[model samples]
Target: MEPGNQTHVSDFLLMEVTDDPELKPLLFSLFLSMYMVTILGNLLIILAVSSDPHLHTPMYFFLCNLSLADICLSTTTVPKMLVNIQAQNQHISYTGCIAQVCFVLVFIGFESCLLAVMAYDRYVAICHPLRYTVIMTPWLCVLLILVLLLLSTGDALLHGLVLSQLSFCRDREIPHFFCELDQVIKLACSDTFIYTILIFFVVGLYGVVPLCGVIFSYTQIVSSVLRIPTVGGRYKAFSTCGSHLSVVSLFYGTGFGVYISSAVTDSSRKTAVASMMYIVVPQMMNPFIYSLRNRDMKGAFRKLISRITSL
Candidate 1:
């Protein structure tokens, strides 16, 4: 390998959704709108949770963090894609690509772990109602967020380091809108056997562990819900975690859809559409899901809007 070839490529050409001149404006407008909505929606959730005294509980705290993570996750890729579409340029610089990878990993990791943490919080609230306050202390919540940050940061750094070491071939065109880790890895001309195995290990460790935690938490919750004497009691208990569960399903469902669809079909465009659902759709839907399904969130937002209107 030549020493010059070993250096990171100056930029990578991102896959455009469509090549039609007429469609460029449509795509740009659509993505820009979605990005704006994602940002505004998640920000509102954070504000509502922060401003409302009643929403200062462990559940809402976790929710606020999740909203922040959603904002970061969308911001990581959508804005850049929108910019590229508007500018008629798909070239993302090497440094920018690496930054996108890091931020995306951190935000997604935060979301996954945060969802699991929220599940445990719900379990305690429903199952161990008496000790919910004591168990989910303010310090504990902060500590949990800190741990999530540390873990996400570590994982992202490891991924970035591994990716930086991988040399790309002459074809630096990534088959997706964003600098997706897997797609970038696939573009590597150099041997990626070890890195591939490492990624699988990391994916399993992060994906399985949190998913298992969520499953276990829900199992306990269901057991407790079933033991409730009244149907209304069960309903109330189930509703407490309903929003989180819905968000979790959307997140994982789209994620798996992207993975499975990419594997089954060789159509990069189809895969990119699926990836949009994975990366963009859930973030857009999360605020709506939480606010609509969770009465507390609705009340908080209602109050927030009323106060802003009065001002």
Candidate 2:
């Protein structure tokens, strides 16, 4: 639509996963369940790590932050979706969409950076075991986390600012469940070339760089693991990293799948499903992957549960 022909829109209609009236109840129930599980599972991870002295290492400290970010990530989109579904109103206000964009960016960036930091922690633990403690000092951990938070906040605000400059039409309908940055930009009446450039830059910087760091860290970790002589020792070494590797794979795999699906197909419904797999599934799965696979997390969670029950 031309800029002069566009009517200023205060709200946008979110695309529904299905137009079938019969599916609304099913969709609502399914999403609500997923959201609740994501919250509860990640919250338990935070509590387990915080309350257990044994889990007070740099790794679990990052895990706690990751859990918190997962909660935030799930929260940024799910509740609004649930509300819209229940109310049968797909409208999200202009200000609300902007807020959604900001929070999602912040939380996703947090997850991405935290994963990279976790990978680095694994690298130090495995590759330079003798100097691991000295290398990943508590101060350094805090500093890294602070830097991530600052960077994510700045990036989110910058995206939001750029997004606010776009002119949207009256029948503003987002092709996804939430006000995703890209989808919102696609609806703009004005030029989005600059916005596209910003996205590419952000993806390269925030997404690709951290992901490459993870791959590099794991490469070192694998080499170090391979050098261990005994099978038992090698198993033990790999076991330590198993949970983290799983979470990282799930996070990036689903994320990449979403991007690929979006790019390959014109089906918004399929893209929305892929987005859910990216955002909701990983958050819901992280706690389970860690708690079930890692002995430390399991022990901590059991103690946490037992303590709660006793109280």
> lDDT tens digits, residues 51-125, model 2?
999899999999989999999999999999988888889999999999998999999998898999999999999
**TM-score of candidate 2 relative to the true fold:** 0.96
RMSD in Å for all candidates: 2.0, 1.5
Model 2 residue 58 distance off true place after TM-score fit, in angstroms: 0.3
TM-score of each: 0.97, 0.96
Write model 1 residue lDDT over 1-311, tens digit each, in one string: 33234345888889987889899998888888888898999999999999999888999989889988888899888888887888889999998998899989998888888889999999999999999999999999999999999999999999998888888877788889999998888778789999999889988877888999999999999999999999999999998889999999998888899889999998998998898768899999999999899898899989999999999
Q: Give the CA lDDT, 0 to 100, for residue 53 in model 1.
A: 90
Position 174, candidate 2: lDDT: 87
Each model's total of backbone clashes:
0, 0
Looking at model 1, residue 68 earns an lDDT score of: 89
Distance from true location, Cα of 144 in model 1, Å: 0.5
